[model samples]
Target: MAKIEDQRIVIDCTCEVQLQQTIIDAVYLALKLEKEICFFGNYLNTSEKEHLQQRTAFYANFVKKDIPSLPVSVLLLEGKLNKLVKELGEKYNTILYCYSGAMDNRLLEAFYRSGFPFYFSKKQVSNSNQFSKILIPVDFRNSSKDSALWGSYLGRFCNAEIKLLVANEKNTEDQDLVASNTESISRLFNQFSFPWSSVLGNSSSWGIHKEAVKNEEPFDLIIFAGSLNVTLVDKITGTFEKRLVNLSEKSVLLINPQRELYLICS
Candidate 1:
């Protein structure tokens, strides 16, 4: 089994229809990764804290009923959402956030600035307890390695099959870099004895994610290495990470390329 430094998965609880499914998805991942679970919510006042606690308790109990052996904690945090998230990121390597079908700019910003990888999901759990197939879109950037590392971890620990979507760049230098990345990623997967396949994408680096999300092949999750720098256009519209997280129907595992990530050890 692969071991992580923290070995804890934090689930951000909300009062949305996606709440129950989020818990289920988190439990599934926690069990697979052999990590403890924490259900977290933010509250402003005493009344709100009580209400959030009740909501978290109800769902935590539901999860406990089925998986009695799992270690679970429920916490009501008091602070700005971004500050709270940054604090949590310091203690935990992974955080799970479920979208309520509506875009929450504050929540997205919190996750973006936290400098940690986050699992973003919707109302429905696509793979349920088994994340059998994972799609990773790879480009020439060094950050692509982080996403590949995550894929290898899941592939080794959760028995997931990795599918790499390679970006097709027109520039010779970029294309050469892309080839090198593909070779390196393939080598990593081979070293771990995990099953992975690669397919060339017919889009630019920024647009390959769209192709991956819209691909005909069924995938349980899409792992993306996001850029930290935001341009003026990105602000007016949204960053590529935000757009991918919002538009993807399948769950997305978003990794901050700028952060030094902790790898799973054998």
Candidate 2:
């Protein structure tokens, strides 16, 4: 866990259909850990009066829920974030999400900064889902480094058989090049001490990537790294980060490279 400047945030617990379970998990986790929580939620969905009673385990539970966001409004989530933490007698804080990415993740990009502490689910799926296999997409980029490190740590925690996958792009003329490097992927996994079988999968093209996301056998979770500064060109363009949130029947944990975490709760 990493710690940043003493700033607390109030992330919106209010949301639509696809994200409801995650909000519950996030709020419950906050309450269960006894962290002084500033909740931004809907009265109908999650009321402070109802939820305060739910947080019985934590020793010092400081929380305030039910702050509404108007239609087409962008309130200073950071300010509210700090207020929540300060009210709870905490130091550093800000609001965040378990499944935010740069392109699609608004709450995070607004709040994330150098040396800021953050936390997301290491277990990347809803509590209702069960897993026997975990797929990790690994690359050598800085963003991928966070993905791989977190994936390894998380896979071990879940006790799932870890599959370390890498992308291999071979043009028609480069078949030999692709075949030659078959063993190299295994070598990379060995160096990391990640006990995983290797596969040639691309996030771009068909076949492997398609099957990876659409497997009928049930993956429960998919972990991959994407660009940190994910911006969109078109107004209607749905970012990949957002797609993960909407697409995953399970939970998606989007890990960026430079977040510090402070554990107010155990």
Worst 10 residues of 1 by lDDT: 94-103
Q: Distance from true position, residue 263, model 2, in Å?
A: 11
Each candidate structure's count of clashing pairs: 0, 16
lDDT of candidate 2 over 1-266, digit per residue (tens): 22422223333443333333434445453433333234333233335425533432121122222412211111222233323433222332433333222223344343234222233233345464243456655543444444455455444444445665554545543434344333454444455543567676654222332345554235655655433554555225754545544554444445544444333322
Runs in model 1 lying further than 4 Å from the true structure: 1-6, 92-103, 123-129
Query: What TM value does model 2 have?
Result: 0.51
Top TM-score prediction, candidate number? 1
User: What is candidate 2's local distance difference test score?
Assistant: 0.40
Q: Across residues 1-266, which tens digit of lDDT does each residue of candidate 1 receive?
A: 22453456777776555766667777887777677678778877888888888878987787788788897777778976777776665565444444344445776667666555778766554544446889999888888888898888789878888999999999999999889988998889998866889999999787888898888248888998876677789888877787777888877888877667655433
The parts of candidate 2 lying over 4 Å away from their true place are 1-12, 16-105, 111-132, 171-195, 202-211, 231-236, 258-266
**lDDT values, one for every candidate:** 0.75, 0.40
